[model samples]
Target: MIKKLLPFIGEYKLETILAPVMITIEVALELMIPFMMARIVDYGILGDGGMTYTIQMGSLMVLMAIIALIFGALSGRYAAIAGMGFAKNIREGLFKKIQTYSFANVDKFTTASLVTRLTTDVTNTQNSFMMVIRMAVRAPVMLIGATIMAVSINPQLSTVFIFSIPVLGTALYLIGKFAHPRFLDMLEKYDSLNEKVQDFIVNIRVVKAFVREDHEEEKFVDNAKRVKDAQLNAEKLVVLNMPIMQMTIYTSVVAILWFGGNMVIEGTFNIGELSSFIMYIMQVLISLMMLSMVFIMLIISRASFSRIVEGLEEKPVLDDGDADPQLKPENGDIEFKDVSFSYSDDAEHAVLNHVNLSIKSGETVGIIGGTGSSKSTLVQLIPRLYDVQSGEVHVAGRNVTQYKLNTLRDHVAMVLQNNVLFTGTIKENLKWGNEEATDEEVIEAAKAAQAHDFITAFPDGYDTELGQGGVNVSGGQKQRLTIARALLKQPKIVILDDSTSAVDTATDAAIREVFREHLNDVTTLIIAQRITSVSDADKIIVLEDGKINGFDTHDNLLKSNTIYQEIYESQSKGGGINE
Candidate 1:
């Protein structure tokens, strides 16, 4: 994990290096102070030549104190720079890597989980890095340095450090070892808490409409309580560290006072030497306390670090680097030959199986299927959103995987069933299809998608600020806006995956008419549940149980295909068929 995180230190390498160096110097200067004060006491205060030596030693001590303060300040500044910079790099790298994930890759993790890893996990790791650079360097140096000084001053009293150090070390090690697993549990509970919050907020309207606020609140409280319980469990172990540290500190201090006071009385140690030894004992114990805190931080951050590394090192399922960049989807010709696919690798059956079909450029194809018939799954494969387990999907005379992913997707525009829209002006959202599109071009695409009239009805017109996910608009309006965005791309192939479901039949027909007139050269694929939506298509595909039950012109299928005949008869009797 340390190796994985080191590279994120990138441009801050100098700050990371300098922080520890400055801290080490500060510790060294701090160790010198107690020894200097000892000399000031024995030779300057208690000796025959009193005033002159006292003044000189006091001046030296003041100089050392000032230098130590400066080192301490520099170390803090450098640690902050290194910690913040490292975190920024990791966040950027995580986001960029997520952008490269295929649909299958994205399906492995949830949005809430990823958000937590990027924010909470990265923050924990950053804090741990800062503490490691500063206290980690200072504490060990102080411990060893103060130990040597105390031994040199009076080895007999220094025996307290030897006993206290080992005891504190054993206690801290046990606390950290026991607390680590609990901390890991606490972090996982945090991920669940974030997930619940996100889900509740995103679906708040549904909760209100269904009068399920009480249920959601109960769920939220339960999740919150779980987080609290897990935290307390982890903290219960950590709380042991401070008490153990305080006990060691007090024990060492008392032991030094007793033995050293006796030595001073016996003339084996001077009063100045005994005083310095007591100060050294305090420094040693305090350094041990600092080291214990560092260990505790490492225990908490270990889980967060592992989560971050999983996101960073996740290999993308699809990569276009091996594809020929020169190859591109020139036209909208599509073919599926013996293609079989499943959402899971070891599923009992494919969601789409043995599918063989073909469509030429400029043709309008309509697909009708039951809820789980995999119509959207079929269209997603055209852009290589997910790869086939066997056989192949071909577009524009080459395998879909042969063309660079960007090249293939650039030519294919899909307005998904969800009809997602960002929180931006109407024109701004449309520009996602073509970032360089002018105002006129955006208007033209909206007009083509039958969205211009409703957009202009708003007071702000094209510049209206949309709520998140276009919440302010009606469902039909959101669908139209998404269609407009996809049309703005002007791709050779356009797939509407039940995108017009919310619009009335008249409006749906108008949108289809506009497609026929303006997109004469673009291949269009429409998936609809209503018979009227596809009755006039150049070809209508009827999918049943992952197989093509019918594939032909609507009129031809009405006479021959059993599934098509039954659907046409039902819709016609219901007065819903268009033609």
Candidate 2:
């Protein structure tokens, strides 16, 4: 995992390298200061050397301290640069990877999980990387340097740290082992918490309409409590670290003071040496404490790193492969040859069966299906949003997989069942269909969609800012706006999946007229629940339980197909048809 992340450290390579080098220099200077203090006490202050020698050593100590401070500050600055830069690159790379994922790939991960990985997980890894380069290097180096000095001064007193070090190390290892999995579990709980919040906020209007505010609040509190419980469980093991460190640190300190004091009185140890020995013991033990903190951070960061890498390493389910790069979609003619698909590979049955159908360019066909009849799934294959399991889906005289994904999708425009508009001006949102569209072109497309008059009635007209998801617009208006946007693409194939469900029959009829007038040459597929919506199509396909129960015009279907006859009769009672 570390090796994979190393490449993204790219431009920050110098900062990453310099951080540890500067930290090492700072540690060296720090170690020298203690030794210099020993000299000032033993020879300059207590023994024959006196004031002149003391002043010289003191001046040198101050210089080393200043250098150490400068090095410490530089290491911190470089560590921040490297850590933040690495995170920025990872975020960009992760988003790009997500953009490449097919719909099936997106189904494997939730929105909340991805958001958590991009934000909180990345932050955790960044902080860990910074500490790893700075304190991580300094801790071990200081421990080793302090141990060497202490042992040389007097091995007997130093043995106290030797005994204490292993015990603290063992405790820290156990804490990390017990806490690592819990931390991973905690992160999962955080994902759930975020999901609950997102779900509630996105559906806030629905909640209010249903008077379910109390219910939503309870749901949010339950998710938040789950997160708190998971976090507390992980921290239970981590909290042991502090108590163990305190006991070991104080025990080692008392042992050194006792042993060094007796040795000094016994004439084997000098006062300066004893003082330096105590300082070295403090350094060694404090370094161990810092190391334990790093250990805990590593445990959390390891979990976050694994989650991030999971996203980055995922292979896109659909790849254009080594197909002829020059191959391009030429027209909107579509064919499904014995095609079958299931969202999951292990599903007991396919959402689409061995269906064979062909539509010539410029033909407008209507598809009607009962619930769970895979109406959306059937058309999704045209643009290769999902690959067929057993057979082929061809567009423009070539298998969709042979063309570049962007090239195939560019020529096939879909207005999905759920009409979505972004948070932008109406013109900006429409520009998504064709970035180069002019104001006149935009007006024309909206006029074709029967959306221009109402749009002009708005105070800002084309410049009206839409709330997120176009919440500011009526449902019928939002649908018409989406239709206008899709029309602006001027694609050879247009798929409207229940795209007129919200519009009144009059507006629906007018929009169909516009389709006949302006988009007559483009191959169009309409999926609708109402029989009247498809009554006038060139052909109508009736699907039942993933199979084509009937394929004919409305009048022929009502005469021959039982399923179509039932649907037509039901909608007829509701006065759905005009003629």
Candidate 2 collision pairs: none
| Model 1 global lDDT (CA atoms, 0 to 1) | 0.91
lDDT of 1 by residue, 80-124 (tens): 999999999999999999999998887887887889889999999
Let me know the TM-score candidate 1 reaches against the reference structure.
0.96
Write down the TM-score for model 2: 0.96
Candidate 2 lDDT score relative to the true structure: 0.91
For 309-346, candidate 2 gives per-residue lDDT tens digits of 99999999999876677777778899989988888895
- lDDT of each prediction vs. the true structure? 0.91, 0.91
Q: In candidate 2, which residue ranges exceed 4 Å CA deviation?
A: none
Quote the lDDT for 303 in model 2. 86
